[model samples]
Each structure stands twice: as structure tokens, then as C-alpha cells.
Target: MTSLLSAQESGIVLGSPLFAHINPRQLPQLLTQMQASRRRYNQGDWILNEGDPCQAFGLILSGTVQVLRDDFMGYRSIINNLESGDLFAESYSLAPGRRLTVSAMAAAGETGILFLQQDFFTDREQISRGGQDSAQVRANLTAILATKNLFLNRKLSYLSQRSTRQKLIAYLSDQARACGSRRFEIPFNRQELADFLCVERSALSHELARMQQAGLLQTRRSYFELAEQLPETDSPI
Candidate 1:
């Protein structure tokens, strides 16, 4: 909705698109008076770990951060990627005593975030009085959660297939469906996609090339164009 964060900007503006739809106007004066800070995390820097106390919530003002969880065997799986303008730790912000269930880290370059504390949301009376605004905020939250659930369902479908090629194809097919077209742009690069898909970068590239050669898809950088059908013998997974 807003231009990606600028390299020259040191911090996020309160009125930025990152918070545009969050309905701060419904917050009380005390909450609206909350302070803000900019934090920088280097590549691979851990922002938070699972089971850690949720001290503050943040928004990604710049760069990319990956939300992931590690299994008992120490294998990590990415849950999602937060880009500029995306909110992070929202559930933590709302639920003070809750523990973080996943870890976050800067995927590349330095990540910049806008942090706010629980004190910023202290005035429940104001929120209650701002009836329509509060309703809008609740509606927005519900819609976002619904979208997230849909995304999770799609991810599950993508991962259920056994074939690596089928997995990639399934992901592309879902993306196409989400965009309501055969041609669509992917939000992640090869490395990020590999992480999202739990595959090696080179392996993803090879598979993508193979898919294109097989007439199942076409790509120019992050933009992919999918065919309505795969090769006759490939068989849908």
C-alpha cells in the first residue's frame, strides 16, 4: 500500500502505511502518546526465540525477517516472511503473558523495525467509546486472520505431496489461483522461496528450470507465468 521503506529513512513515521489501517485513532490519549524506536538486526540475527516473554510488538519497516520454528531434532521450518510494512509480534502485543511460539531472524541485509510497548494500548475506555472505529479494527483483524488461515491451508496442500517437482508445481498453482490468473509475480526471491518451501536454493532453481522446459511454467526473475496444464505424463500429485 505504501512504497517500500527507503534506505535513507532512519525511522518509521507514525502515519505511515504500516499503521494506516491499524486504527490508532480509537486509542486513548495515553496510548496515542506511546514512544517509538528503531531497531536494527543484522543478517541471521535472532530477534526472538520460542517461549520467550513477549515484551514488545513490532512492525517491519525495512528488510526481511523470517518466522520459524525448530523441531526437537533442531530442524528449522519457516512459517512466514515479513517484509516492509508487515506487522510482527501482533499476537504478542495483544497477549502480554503469552510466549512466542516461533523465532524470528533477519533473512538478509539489516532488518529495521518499529517497536511499541503494551503501555501504548492501556486505555480500554477510549477504545470502547470509539465504537465504529473499534468495530472496524476488529473486522480488519478477523479478515487478516481469515486470509492467514487460507494461506496456511494452501501451504498444507503444497507440502502434502511427495514429489519435489509436484510440491513446486503445487505452490505455483496455488499462487496462480490466488492471483486469479495464470501470470503472477512471486513475492519472494529464489533464496526466500527455497526457505519458504524448505528446499535448497540450487534445487529450486533446477526444478524451476525443469518446469519451464517441460512447458509447465515460465519465469522472468520473480514473475512466473504458469500453464493451465502440466505435461500429460507428469500426472497431478
Candidate 2:
């Protein structure tokens, strides 16, 4: 991990949810207080591995972070993809003494992240982190954690779908909604998309082809456009 954050890097850190209401001038002192550092990784690099003791809360500073689960035979499943400004590992970090159940990996080039070493909300932790008490930062951290938890429940809903088409529709619809447009680019390619949906790669490809032919959606690589009237019937859980 790098000890210093460049001017541009400092802007990214200050703009993050965890630093909400914090002044730019106070960042260096705050980073020092929390024992946090910035780091960047190349594509496919491991940011956090499963079963490892979790001590820090990680925030994606740039590029993408793919949270993955592995099976006994080493097959991998994509739990979720987090983009720049997204937070990860907060749950474990807050609880303390818990090991990670999934791994976080770089999805593409130069994935940068910030790791803050203690529970942001705990009074003792706040005192230990230099007695710089800021209620705004604590409120911001609580809101961010709650938002992440809601998204996790949404992911669980997608994973429970019985069909590849159902899973694809559910996930894509949410992506479109998130972007506020019918057209949007997703973080995953075909294989990674299959892993995210917990479906076979071949099945996912075939289903996409069928959906395109049926005029339900049009996709090229990672970009997609959903028909105004989606074919999804079941309400999202």
C-alpha cells in the first residue's frame, strides 16, 4: 500500500461516502488517524481473499472490484461487482474478529482502493483513531453500510432465480434502473455475467442470443439495451 496519496487521489478519497462532510484540508490528518492507505492493483489481482481475517473497510477508489465465492473444486462465482466510490468489507470491519467469506479481485486495470483500519462508528475506535470525533462522518458511514446491505439482498434475489433468462432480466433491469436509462454498460462480460447469475456460460450466451432475436433486448459485449416492455413477470424480491 502506498503511504502517500497524490492530489488527484486525495480528491477521490475526500469525495467518498466515508469522508462525507469532511474537509479536504483535514484528509491527511484523518487518514493518519484511521491508519488508512491507498493502493492500486492490476487486473485479476486479489484485493481480499476468502477466509482471511478482516480488519479494514475497503472503498473502491477507481476501476472495479469483483466479489467472488469459490467452491471445493475451485470454481468461482461472482457475488457482485463494485465500481469506483463503492464500499466493501464494512460489515466485517465493524464486527471485528470475523473472517471474510468471499474474495475481492480487480475486474480490470488499475483498480485502486482505500483501506481504513477500524470500526468507523465505535466510540472506542474513534478515540483510538486520534480522538477526532465527527458525527457527520459517522452518520455517513452508517448510511453507506445500510445502502450496501440493501443491494446485497437484491443480489440474493437474483441468485435464487431458477432460469438463466429470469436471472438475466432481473439483473439487467436493475442495471438500467440504476443508470436511469434503458441503455447502460455492465461491469461483466459473458463469462463473468454467467458467474454472477450462477448459471452456465453456454446457457447465458444462448439465452442472450434468443433474447436479442425475440426483440426483448439488444446486447453487444458489455453494453445492453432493454426493450421498453421487459419480459420479466415475477416481481423483484
Best by TM-score: 2
Cα displacement (angstroms), candidate 2, residue 87, comes to 2.0
How many Å off is the CA of 65 in candidate 1? 1.9
The runs of at least 3 residues in candidate 2 whose Cα sits more than 4 Å from the true structure, single-residue gaps closed, are 1-3, 123-133
Tens digit of per-residue lDDT, candidate 1, span 1-237: 112334344234334443345544333332234445568999989988898987676777778888888879766678887787666676776685799998988887988886766554545764466555444544654565576677777777767766668778878877787899999997787877776777777888998888889888899889998888853323233
84-178 per-residue lDDT for model 2 (tens digits): 77788888877757899999999888998988876545657565554343566677888987887798899888877778888898899999999
Q: Candidate 2 clashing pairs?
A: none
- CA lDDT, every model vs. true structure: 0.69, 0.82
Per-candidate clash tally:
0, 0
Query: What is the TM-score of candidate 1?
Result: 0.70
Residue 125's C-alpha lDDT in candidate 2?
58
The TM-score values for the models, in the order shown, are 0.70, 0.90
Judged by lDDT, which candidate is best? 2
- The residue pairs in collision within model 1 are none
66: Cα error in model 1, Å: 1.5
